[model samples]
Target: MRALMMPHRIVMLAVAAGLVAWIVLTGNWSWLPKYAPMIGQGVWRTIWLLVLSVMIGFSLALPLGLAQASGPWYLARPARAFCTVIRGTPLLLQIWLLYYGLGSLFPGIPWIRESELWPILRQAWPYALLALSLSYAGYEGEVMRGAFASVPRGQIEAARAMGMPRRKIFARISLPLAFHSVLPTLGGETVLQLKATPLVATITVIEIYAVASRVRQDTLITYEPLFLVAAIYLMLAGLIVLGFRWLESRQPRRAA
Candidate 1:
């Protein structure tokens, strides 16, 4: 794979200059020092939440897409249904249901409350993470299904003709091709996933958006905090695009 893009030095420096100018010249800075630590924590939490959920969701998408694309009817039907339902529903509704409905249900269950995992089960972040991960999986599952289906049947037949076992054939051929097919799309999905991280703030996760909200509440300066939040997300999305473009550049070359 191509090295992950670090982005352009000149453009990045210019953007940095612009942001610094904005921070210094335009907005209220008095509150920043007091809340700097909280903002730092929020930024870290947002990035962590996005990265972990995407990794978990993409891992799930592989099997889910494969099941729908090529597995037996039983597996395909359920996988199809899952993708349909998740894609159909509003992500906000799913988060609320999981956090309010299932979270409340878990506490009422005596065994769950008594279990060793009760502490984790009581928190909002776990539910938020679950909702985000499943949302990513649901969307990416369809992308992967299409990618898997597009893999040339001739390639599979060639491998099979060479006496390659089914498992080996998939490892050597299908998965990689499908992943490469979807690599460009995966970056866009990741950017969407990053935007979705703000939704977790509604569940008391205290991500960067929530930090912005707090700044607005405490300082009553709306535009400055919002400007910063927008800038942060914009930078993140740019990074994701550049990173994926680099991956696309690294795709294996085929000889004519």
Candidate 2:
């Protein structure tokens, strides 16, 4: 508990209090009541985008990472190329490519535009989701590839010696350890992904950043809306850190 009162933490608290006081006393919030519902919807959209993208990306990343870490050349080469392309490209460019490039192209395809799923495909959110999911998969795939590789070879040998099936060994041992090893990294990446959510606004997905933009345009007040957005992000990031810390604490600790 004493750790909570360190100099840096105290300074952070003071700064936060100062910000709150300024917002309450000096900032223009007159438009908030009118836009509150929109703001709420925007926040929900941001959260869902982050959650869905991370889930989908992590799911794809497992196979990608496993392939890169342990698969044969044929499989590994493609996996490596996929991750390389995703990681190498700028996320904004990818978003634009998906939204402006692929998105525009979809309508020209006779079968695709006429398909049942075309309605969903034509929406901006789908492209945003795909871009974000691909981005998260690209970065986390590298992390998971390293995590999988970092699992000691001795564990595999031991499992083999015990006559365990390959799938069982991976399911019970390797996968769990690899995931646990990278949990902290996963949390950090989630925060980064949260920050990246604002980019979706470019394609017209009305998330919190978009809501802030609306507020700025309507009220002609820049700092207040942006300040609120920053505060909200900070709160969200803090919650993620706390959640990860709790998860870490739940793991068994080695005694000195």
Q: Which predicted model would earn the best TM-score? A: 2
Q: Which residue pairs show collisions in model 2?
A: none
TM-scores for all predictions: 0.90, 0.93
Candidate 1, 178-216: lDDT as tens digits: 998899899989999999899999999999999999988
- Highest lDDT scorer: 2
For residues 1-256, could you state the per-residue lDDT of candidate 2 as single tens digits?
A: 7987999999998998997998879988888899989989998999899999999999999989999999999989999999999989889999999999998788899999888999899789999999999999999989999999999999999999999999998898889899889999999999999999999998999999999998888878898889888888998899888988999889776597
Looking at candidate 2, the ten consecutive residues that score lowest on lDDT are 247-256
For each candidate, what is the lDDT? Answer: 0.91, 0.92
> Candidate 2, residue 250: CA error in Å?
2.3
Give the Å error, residue 90, model 1: 1.1
